[model samples]
Target: MTNPIPTEKTPPDEAPRFAELAGQVVVVTGGTRGIGLGIVRLLARSGARLMITGRKAHRLERVADELAKLGAEFETRVSDVADRDASRRLVDETLAAFGTIDALVANAQSYINVKPLLEITPEDFDLVLDTGPRGTLWLMQAVVPAMQARGRGRIVTFGSSMGQTGAPGYGPYSAAKEAVRSLTRTAAREWGRFGITVNCICPASASHRLPTNLDGDDPRARAFAAMYKDHPLGRDGDPLADIAPVVAFLLSDASQYLTGQTLMVDGGGILRA
Candidate 1:
């Protein structure tokens, strides 16, 4: 009897985890860094045609180059999601580039500002809400019509555990994120009949760390660090391993029955009943 040859396995990093997503078109806001970047990387590798938006031209170019290396077809746009016109333009461009929008990841957000509830000014509230719920609302309006035309779409918006838990120091960000949840629920209800699904992910991912302020002495920074230490997994969520797959699932047909839910992806840091 002849001995059978052993098959070589593809390395985990090189394998496509969601090849079924091949040919799907997706738009990701804030796709240049952190969780957004992670989502883009995964989706690209899964063979999605992507239109990614970022506020920085240089960062968008950098991410574009990286996606090219993955052999992913992508278009880059420099736009702030908070601009309603820009949000509409982004959806139009994505539709123009890919012919249709199958999914959207509303991942762009304003910088987090830690402040006491009493100290959070109206301006602070605006800064968060304007970029979050307001931004997402307009973006949804832009894309939903196309989804309705097709009779199907997926939308995944970012929320936070802080919003659900009502964490004290994250007043403004939490309020903005909670508003997003309300919006997600309402949209899911309204859009369900049109075969569009809306959901939010409250992630405790490490990629939320900002590059500009790596302060060691700040109380807010300390609290941020303490979260990872206290998590059941003993670490923060990795955007690639912990979060992107959930976003991918929400985008895929596998989750067609799911909608209007906020999932906490926080290593058991915040569990909702």
Candidate 2:
């Protein structure tokens, strides 16, 4: 049989929207770039009121400019969610801006080091853990009360398939993501009674490295290109087209009954129930 060409669907600009997401207020961490930015674009088109945060003011401004071109108005703040105070402040600001937060997308993580286990340092673990699971928890804690008050909420946390597959040279990233998975399950169970749903998405996509950032000479360029070269769907996913829709579902009223589950949004590169 001949090989199939990789699919690149919708071009992100044509991302579909769920009707229930209209007018909902959502706080998104690391919304300045990559998959997070894709979520911002989709949710914006879906008419969700966006409260976006990131570490870089310049990139945040760029996001605002891009959204303006699409006629999507949004609020942005420079935030480091790894800091407890910062996480709380993001939620407070979201509430202040939009009155109430309907959903939260914890999509930020700092990958400080990608090296073999034997070469990883204590600092690697610290950086990844602080930004990954710890930051996720802080934001969840800060946002849950608002959801609880409303007796309804949706939380989407990020995880990685490498957390279980133990992909090479990703020691810190793997550990941090696994912790996030644990947090997702626990939060789902505890918050389910309050009409809140917590879910995790493990995505494998090319969104993090946009075409503008690609340099053919980079050592990992080929690796990134080849990630899903032989996949079941024949390609790595486009973050906005493949991943953001799932997130939108989890955020909308349609997914109210689903909780404590991990959805692999990776175009079938790795299958897991």
Candidate 3:
């Protein structure tokens, strides 16, 4: 069975709007497609002012049009989080636009080096590390000053079950994600006194960027596909319905007390405890 990925954003009337999110400002990295796009749609519907970032201009333009239809208050930027200057500028621009960045969805990541650990090159590993942990750290550092000044903020970072469980061919990606999880924990502890909450989510959702092999017929791909089909929920998560709602909760005021935790939003994939 195919996962029913919605092409249209849910109309505001059809979904429950979150009062805590109303007028809040959120910065979502890689908000052009897949899980990032899903997060943006949910936040828009819930009345959050959005600053969405993507590497491609046209992708951001399309998302801008979609949010326009929803009457969403938003701004879009073409940015590569891997670039330190761009990441800093992204946070600065978001704060300038929204006056305060109440939350950050550090959801952008690169997919590369699908080869075995023996065949992986230094470049391949560095690319993933730069795109994942390094990028996440840059944005976090840039945003923290403003958030600290305000004495409150929420940060949601992405991790992966494959990262946690040590997937056979995913050494670099796993390393990067674990590094990001470390960043989340350290930041949460250091900044909690200032009212900042940092958390990580490991999601197993139907995404266009579901690594490189799962769509192929390789043995490892077959194993992963079978695992996805046989998870406790019996299907991969719907990004908007299953994953985004959890992100919304993390961004809400209700989650202020929650920090330094990794939530497996993977519908019972036991790859990680």
Best by lDDT: 3
Please give the range of 10 consecutive residues that has the lowest summed lDDT in model 3: 1-10
Better of 1 and 3 by TM-score: 3
Per-residue lDDT of candidate 2, residues 167-268 (tens digit): 667678988999999999999999999999999999865555523322343424433444544567766567788889999999987788899999988877
Give lDDT tens digits, candidate 1, residues 171-193. 88988999999999999999999
TM per candidate comes to 0.89, 0.91, 0.90
Local distance difference test scores for all models: 0.83, 0.83, 0.84
lDDT tens readout by residue for model 3, 1-273: 233223444443454557779899999999998889988988999899999999899999999999999999999999998999998888888877878889899999987846789989989998999999999999999888989999999999999887877777788988999999999999999999999999999985555544355566764565466556546665556667667888999998888889999999887876433
| Model 2 poorest 10 in a row by lDDT | 210-219
> Which candidate leads the pack in TM-score?
2
lDDT of 1 at 190: 97
* Candidate 1 local Cα displacement, residue 162, angstroms: 0.7
Write down the lDDT that model 1 would get.
0.83
The TM-score of predicted model 1 comes to 0.89
Q: Residue 242 lDDT in model 2?
A: 84
